[model samples]
Target: MTEGTIPAALERAAERFAAREALVDGEVRLTYAELARRVRQAARFFEGHERVGICSPNTWHWVVAGLGALYAGATLIPVNTRFTARETIDVLERAKVSALAITGTFLGTDRLAELGSSRPGTVLRIPVEGAEVPFDGVSEWDALTGLDSDFVSPAKPDDVSDILFTSGTTGRSKGAMSSHRQALSVAEAWGECGGLTEEDRYLVINPFFHSFGYKAGILAAILRGATILPQRTFEVRETLHLVEAERITVLPGAPTIYQVLLDAPERGNHDLSSLRLAVTGAATVPVALVERMRTELGFDTVLTAYGLTEAVVATMSRPEDDANLVAHFSGRATAGFEVKLGEYGEVLLRGPNVMLGYLDDPDATAEAIDTEGWLHTGDVGVLNERGYLRIVDRIKDMYVCKGFNVYPAEIEQALGWLDGVAESAVIGVPDAVYGEAGKAYIRLRPGAEVSTADVLAHCKANLANYKLPRYIEFVAELPRNLSGKVLKRVLREENG
Candidate 1:
């Protein structure tokens, strides 16, 4: 594959598929030409800006600003849409963002004012909806949109393109700096591995703020010259309708989308035969659901990939991978990526896709990536003899039990396999006998009933006594981040 920048890739594809649909949202369809033009206009909007912050929903504005910022040779700070005013202000200050582009009065919050206070002269606000207004020295969104700038800032492989803030589930959020080359590398690699072509049409479900959503959904489709069906929000029936109506070839989402589709009664009525590839990750998926997609939904290819915001993407299970293995392992490490089990059994990664550094926090950067250049993933994993990697559990999530190591995922997986169990979360709780003991939180399927004693008895058959959860509690829903990852730290705090 020829190595080229993201803008170059999109430009080349636009030449081939100029009039072809690029992003389709019902009546609104953006062709490759239109997408390029919008991206260029966005780049023109950010001319002379050092740092531009974008806090918008999953829509054309987000993609346009993201690509535009990259083209303008300015660092982009993506503020989380769900963040409170204080949180939003925190991200802008940490990233030193001078300009901002937001959608729809930023959900009626005064966050823009809060951010403006930090950098008075440099603040530029662009509203995603309606005509942009000049607010506190910021240019109107439309005024910046029409500016003509012939300057095309060529991005090097190593130049910082975007800054993505962490979810801050455990602590303060840090901005991970991603370079143009690194982001493009992951998108291109995924395009090749998935055998993406000009004909494939992908439905974009994941939020574009996340690495998976940006690289996998928007950028990857651009590189492949494939069509993108962008959904502002995910609904089971609506997604099914789009997949059937557009003949969507690729469906990439977290386990929640799959679980919802599996439970939808209309799932049987929809024509999902067009779905060739279903790539999911960022959450643990039950093996039964994996099998059901193959037998019921007619997904010929279902893969699970594991990666973080800093690393972009590291590993994925191939289409040829055994269904059971795809259910177990997160494929092989992506091209230009290497994974090694550290002395502490933690998954350590080294690759070009690894983030350059954290914005304004060298200490946190150094803590995450060591002197040896290996990124400490803090994930417990083992590489099989066949070179497939299976993440056992998070290193931080593992607890000690009477001098024995207890992995929450091991117990959680066992619990999920039990009858009537839908989803489960396991956390370490303080115990008098042992320093810490495993506690399980469960959410049963609709109309399904199971007792704590029955769950414990079921786990006893699948797990060793040492790994058995000491306590069990049933909950209506488990605590999860926007990305659908269980926040075990929250569970531990609650147990305390």
Candidate 2:
């Protein structure tokens, strides 16, 4: 095993459970030995690359290829499958990806090898059971698809091993280069927060390609020698079935997932009692919802955490935090993390877990991380005298209405406390004269009748006029990624 890589941690896990199930999907399970073999085979295909692209849907293949890349001493770039062909082209062009291990045809084209070969890179199509490579002259993902079972991890402590593209909400997406040590630090911190152990079983509902899944979910689980149940989609019923059947011990999902589960009528039929810990984050967790789940589902330990693609699992509220506060504030930055309240109360983080920098964009990197090494989080929060951090809102999410500042979080929190409101998202929309006005998109509780005017009146009574949303749009549900973050930018564009 090499120094400073998750593959090193995974190797240790394999030793403990070589024949144990490491991945499962729809009755399909891969033992530790099988998983290690596939990973090595994938690595052999990329024997001499500095970087490789792992473009696949949420599956065990993505995990194997990612692990293989690190084991082979190459950086891995995880592409978002949701991107259009044009958007996918942009990311591929910018990253200068030398090779690809792809699943699912992109742009109605089956040949990733042909599409990527023209871009100064070789594309390798991963083998689909008993199938041939889709493109002529292109290497197959299984070209060397077998390992010695004596596979070892290879990575430098300071090697930047993964390049994750930002969510691109604020602007053009830039890749965050995370070093092995940095990734491991965050993963270790997450393991501690969740009280992970080899006895625990995790359901991998989050995409393995994302930073949260790679570092906190998958890597942390691997470090603990825990089993991972992978899901290719976020179907509520399918997820519940896995939890019940696998007797999953630890389940981490976005708040939206909980909301959906709670709303499911058959939710009561699933035996979620086996779930000891429920880690929720990527967005604010509603206090009422948390309380409901605790009272109804019996998950006493609901931990809320906060982090981004740049820094995986920064602040997390432990199971020890008051459920109310945990729902309110994703715990303070993890141990060794430094949070400084900058001018205007924007929270800035200084820690070993910060990304190496945005890949190939020195200017953006400089703007995000200061000379002092603090990553400007662009989030607004206030530190209480007790040193607890309370997120006020995002800098970009704050709007000015009639010369007064309105933070979306404040409004969302207020609206969330109301009856029959499952989830809420506040965005600033164009106003004729007030410059900008708050627009609230809400998802109501099942069978609950809460009129727009009634909600407006409720906000009017509790909040100042500036904070009151001028327009209210009731949505069936908020748009979210697999991680459970409300795609506010998506809503803003659609509404605009």
Candidate 3:
């Protein structure tokens, strides 16, 4: 249990729980001993490489490849599956990846061909079960997994484990370099916070490319002796079936996921009695929704956590907290983190979970982390007297309308309280009178109807005059990334 590196941790788990199931992906299942054997075998393929890239969906292959890179003393870079060829190439080049392990196709696109002539150094193809896609001059995953080797190079706790890129919502994505110690600290904190146990069956709906899935989902399960059920994407019916069949004990995702489940008519028919722990965060959560998930859904413990890619699992609502406090604010900082509010109401953090710096960008790194080691989270929040943090909105997302600062998150939360509103996003638009005005885009619940006037009236009663939205437009859906975050840039580009 005193392992310093991720691979070493896996080794310890294999020795203790060799017969326990470690991973499950559809028809594929691997126990701790089997997974460790495959990891050692795959590690030999990356023996000489310093940086390795993994571009695949949430599968056992992705986990094996990533852990194998660590066993070989290589830095792993998990590229986003939704990234275009240009974006993928940018990451590969910037990370100086010496090898790439990618699937042939994903969502009907030939991923390998899309990255045409942009092979980093060695290209390894991970074959999908039903996909008949083909590639030339690429090594197959079987070749690597079939190799016989037990070599594991020594890795220190301070060695860089992975470089995770930001979502680039405001600008170009910056790679946040995290050391092994930082990554493991996050896993330990999350595992303890969620009270993960050996009997828990965790269904991972979050993508592995993001920290929410990689650090909190997979590594946390490994830290405990829990079983992992990797889900590639979120679908209501399929997820319900898996939950019932797998007897899933732990399920975590964004608030939108629970909303979809609550709206489904067949949800009541599923035997979700096995569900006990539910964790969600990353967006504004309504108090009503939190109450519903517990009272209506029969969940014993529902928790909300707050963290960014730079610092994973910084604060989390404890199980003993009331529903309103869990919904209204992200709980107190974790044991190792120091949380403070800056002069301008920005949330600041200093902890082991904080990243070392941005890769290859010293200027950007300096701008993010100060001389005192406090990471300026670019987010506006208020820490109450009891130390709970209520995130207002992103500093970059705030707009000045008529000389008053307007926060979109506050408007969106208010809109969620409306009768017919399913989701809403607000952005600043050009106005002739106020220089800039609030424009709201909304998606109503199915079979629910509400007029623009009704929405405007509700906003007028709940929000200040300057904070009220000047324009309202109803849409079927709002543009969102894979992580369930609203794409404000796309909305601005379309409306502007």
Candidate 4:
């Protein structure tokens, strides 16, 4: 791997594979040279900006804007498109974002207008799937073209490249800071493990807001010279059609992604033989699912991985591993990283790729990474005789719903805003499509007439779509211990 910054890597890729296909989005296509020019144009557009925020779905515009910020020596903060205005504003404020690339009125929601006067300095409104509602003082996203005199700032390997916010069990989200070196190193490691090459065409269904999509999906494609096809949303038929139509060779997502592909009634109608590599993780993986993915989906290589935002790619299965090993274990520690069990079998990792620290929070940083540099992950896992890690329990009350972590406390805090509900508890339950789904238990105030529809409506407005609970049940009283703490175990058992 080249010991250079992301922008430098992009420059190298442009020169090495100038005419190679780099991006494909809807009707637009760009070669590596053209993609580099587009990124420079975006960088020139954001000349004076410092920290940049992107709050849109996966698109070619998102790719250019995000890379443009990094290329211009600004810290990139990718905001979840599913978040409401309030939630998005919280992250922007936390990061002190000076420029923002937000889509105009998407899917009947004017995210820009919703942000109101609290909006950041510069806004690049990308016109996506919805009518562009009139908003004041915004620049056109697609109109950016590099001026001959525009200067692009260079970034160092150690400079922070991105600040990705992740919710914790404490109900507040923390920004995980990664330097250019860490991001590029992890992307290269992932690409090498998957054997991503110039011959491969990757369909990135993962959202760009998360590491799996941005780093593993897009960044890896840049480093390895794979053609990237961004799908803004995941639908059963459309996804299958993309695979068959584009001859997508490399696809990585959660187990649920493969499950839906297998369960699709029209699975027989599509020619998915071009699929070469498939990576899935972040939730339970049944051996049968792995076997079926290999046998039915016709993927030549299938691997599972275990990672958190703090350490992007801790453990991952190699291509040669068997289906049973791939299903049961999350591979061994990758190169340049060491994984060991701390007290009570807690998984601890030490690596150059681990996040530098939480943004602007020294105390929390100290608590997470120890004096010896081992990050004390709150996940419980057991290493097999051959050192493959199998995650068994999460000490934090968090669950993976469709590859994204859903902390119950975050949803519970959102539910607290409802008018009628006195208290609520959220838990994860098994789902056929989404590996796990959220189930909320509401304790209404005396004589309160809040219905399930009301709870769902409030959640839809405040929380991201992934955080919304699929099940809502009202309760007279929540089971509590003598100390007045809600017994979540009881709720899980009763739910069962």
| Prediction RMSDs, each to the true structure | 2.6, 2.5, 1.6, 11.1
Greater TM-score among 2 and 4 belongs to 2
The C-alpha lDDT values of all candidates are 0.79, 0.78, 0.87, 0.83
Model 2 off-target regions past 4 Å? 105-121, 127-133, 139-153, 494-496
Ranking by lDDT: 3, 4, 1, 2
Provide the global lDDT of candidate 1 against the true structure: 0.79
Measured by C-alpha RMSD in angstroms, how accurate is candidate 3?
Answer: 1.6
Task: Candidate 4: give the clashing pairs.
Answer: none
Cα TM-score per model: 0.93, 0.93, 0.97, 0.80
- What's the residue-level lDDT of 425 in candidate 2? 94
- lDDT (tens digit, per residue) of candidate 4 on 156-185: 899999998874334577899999999998
How many collisions per candidate? 2, 1, 0, 0
lDDT of 2: 0.78
Q: Considering summed lDDT, which 10 consecutive residues are worst modelled in model 4?
A: 478-487
For residue 233, what is the lDDT in candidate 4?
75
Q: Who wins the TM-score comparison?
A: 3
